[model samples]
Target: MSMIGLVDCNSFYVSCERVFQPRLCGVPVGVMSNNDGCVIALSNELKALGIKMGTPAFTLQPLVRSGQIHLLSSNYELYGDMSQRVQAVLEEFSPTVEPYSIDEMFVRFDGFAHAPLLEHARQLHHKVRRFTGIPVCVGVAPTRTLAKLANRAAKKIPAYQGVCILHAGSAETRNLLQKTELGDVWGVGRRLVERLALMGIKSAWDLAQANPKEIRRRFSVTLERTAQELRGVPCIEMIDLDEARQRIMTSRSFGKLTDDLDEIREATRQYGQRSAEKLRRQNGLAKAVLVFLKTNPHRQDLSQYSPSLVLELPRPTADSREILHAAGLALERIYRKGYLYQKGGVMLLDLIGADRQQLSLLDTPQSDAERQRSQKLMDVMDTLNRRMGRDTVKLGMPTPGAAWHLRCAHRSDRSTTRWDELPKVRAL
Candidate 1:
């Protein structure tokens, strides 16, 4: 039986903030989304206070005014830097650590059936806490779905002490499944829940004992695989780091609604820079560029327009300038007056590796010297930015004030990334 362990950071963004300012420990806190618009993360205290995720920040301003709750803007630079530290600690414990998300990872067992897996998990938790100061829950089981259950239980139940292990095909695993709700099971959505409830499959154990062929006929093969995994059978494979994505997109909602085309153009340039960077990192080039703009549909009084366009490139390339130019033209074709656009983005589509593409018939061929120079220039820019910091080097993207930029008014100091922001110390 294959044993899989999942480690999940608790309220990741909130935990990242508490790491440096120990004063925030046990305090009610929330991390807002782009534009500091909504609460995207909540600490335990905030959760106990009935403050739910995605609640508008304006609605919670009363709590902040009363000093009962505090809010932090989404400081991705700080959060991402902290995530790297946590991953470094995880790598020490497992050679097969698969990062499922920024705050979650799966560790597949190599040969640890004979070892004290539960004890090992406890030790891993300590090391991570000491190194990164982020609390995590660890769950070990025969499959990924069961591990997810165990992880949830570890976090919710005080008895688990942040680590829970369920042996493959063990009696404890079955009992745990009986207690787990169908809604809580991995891959079970609201639609699946309603269908499963009608079939009298209220819990994971019920689904595990259901007829697999019937489930497949009624639903999807994916659900059938979930039932098998619930029965201590391996179904979901670990994700590959280099897996090709269907499309690459980078976008964010603005701080406030705006109809200005210049500001929208600047947003596209920023997103284009990011998308092209990701394309180059993946060793792929895109044959088409996509641009999308969305306006607030909730306001019935105001004219709302959400338009998207796709334009094929003259030549497929991962060059940021080329992608931005294509995106600009697409925006020009689709942009309309009189609508307050709230969000925009750029997408790189129809990706293929550079070595695999055939040039367009109308494309002007690049000279070998010109191609070499372009490649060298991009390499140098990427290197400098990596060495200094993100976007330390720019490609015509606005560096100064832009009205469409995300608002992080209450952002914490990026102590780890900035010199002046670093914590000060004085001799007593």
Candidate 2:
């Protein structure tokens, strides 16, 4: 029997913060999304306080002011750095480590015996915590679907002690699945849960016992695969972690609404540059650029206008200059003069591998030397931003007090990335 283990970090974003601020470990802590808009991550204590995920900061002001709950702005740089540290620790334990998300990894323990497999999982849980200060639960089972369930069991069941291993066709596995709700199963959405419930498949075990072909006939091939996976048959193919994205989007809500064209233009330009950087990192080129502006839909009193435009690039390129120029033109076409904009974004669409771009018959052929120079310039800019901080080598100066800047007043320091922001320890 093959053994696959899932390693999932506990309250990942909140845990990342706790590593730097130990005082927050026992307190109710929540992490807010961009512009301090809404709660995105929460600790167990915060959940117990009845502060649900996606609750706006303004709604939780009373709890915050009373010092009953602490909400910090999402510091992605710290969380991403911490996630990499956890992954680095996992690589030491398994030959095949597939990152399922920033906080979840699937590892193969194919050759291990049952007893040794359990022991190895415990060691992994300990090592990740010890090395990265991020607590993780490990679930080992016959298939990836079962592995995910096992990991959840390790988290929710106190008896598991943060590690759960289930073999194929085990009585214990069936018992656990019976207790698991249909909605809790991986890949089962709310609508699917309703449909499955109507068909008397109310729990994970019920779905596992379902006929795979019947499920496919009634629903989709994807749901059929889920059923197969539930039966300890490996059907879902693991995606390569480094696979290139088909499209890249960079967007965020502004600090405040503004009708100033220059402010929106600057935001669009920044978004385009960021999207281009992502394209270069993945070694992909964008054939089209999309620029969009959105108004506050919740503000019924204000005049609303949301518009977007897509412009094809003259040539498939990952060059930020070309991308930004196209974005500016697109913005000019879609942007209205009177409406207040709350959010703006840029998307790089119709992406292809940088080396796989097809030449058009009427396209002016660029020299190899010119392409190399453009690539080199972007490389230098990216390197400088990495070595220094972001925006160290951008195309234009940002306007001071720009309304489009994110309103992250409670964001923690970027301790892992910026030199000056590193945490300081005092001798007591």
What are the Cα lDDT values of the candidates? 0.87, 0.91
Q: In lDDT terms, which candidate is top?
A: 2
Quality of model 2 by C-alpha lDDT: 0.91
Angstrom error of the Cα, residue 284, model 2: value is 1.3
On residues 150-269, what C-alpha lDDT tens digit does candidate 1 reach at each position?
999899888989999887667888888999999999889988999889989999999999999999999999999999999888888866788777689999988788888998999999
Best by TM-score: 2
Residue pairs in candidate 1 whose N, alpha carbon or C atoms collide under 3 angstroms: none
lDDT score for candidate 1 against the true structure: 0.87
lDDT of model 1 at residue 108? 72
Model 2 lDDT-worst window of ten:
360-369
Off by over 4 Å in 2: 359-366, 426-428
